[model samples]
Target: DTVSYGRIFKADKQTRIASVGIGYADGVPRALSNRLIVKINNKKYHQIGRICMDQLMIEINDENPIAIGDEVILIDPNESKDLTLEDWAKLTNTITDEIICQFTTRLKRIEI
Candidate 1:
């Protein structure tokens, strides 16, 4: 993602911003930079800023009622709510298989 992707960062009252504890070192594509999305409490939020080596930011809604230690959905099969690997694949212009392969040991895969 380019610098312009998060050039103007602003969070309204309705939006709750979160900094996730995962980043490019954990295989988040730098290309996703600020052009990616994550799901929290079954709602989609835009990822903002350059994806770091160990973190990224998401803009959730205050109405969604999020808190520290909430389980965030990154890649999921829940098409109606969670973000899928295919979504990241499209954002990074890569295939789903490649996206899956890029995941590193820093991440713990959990199924719910």
Candidate 2:
């Protein structure tokens, strides 16, 4: 155990909702644990359930919203739709650098 934590993500942009593939066993520190606040269509939604080793769950109840393959912001420069890394830092008393680096290189990043 590398002493990492997990976060439930329900990020979005306008109406494109996304549930991130992230969780505890992925080196997500338990300290940074909670229902993550994702700004979608200028609103926040709750990430439901306890985080798993590979992925957590989120609610995507938008009307005529995005599909399974639609693009959603997980970690992007667009702060308007998703929570800032600074927010994560504040929440866990960590830093932005640490938070972003949490993911191992083996993880594939699909930015849309």
Task: Give me the candidate number with maximum TM-score.
Answer: 1
Model 1 TM-score relative to the real fold:
0.77
> Mind giving the per-residue lDDT tens digits that candidate 1 earns over 22-112?
8888998988876777777777788877787888888665566888998877777858433778778887888989988889999987798
| Model 2 stretches with alpha carbons more than 4 Å out | 1-20, 25-32, 39-44, 80-82, 109-112
- Model 2: per-residue lDDT, tens digit, 6-94? 33333344333345666665655445445466444445665554556776555667664545654444444567433777766777789
* Highest lDDT scorer: 1
- What lDDT score belongs to each candidate, Candidate 1 first? 0.76, 0.56
Clash list (residue pairs), candidate 1: none
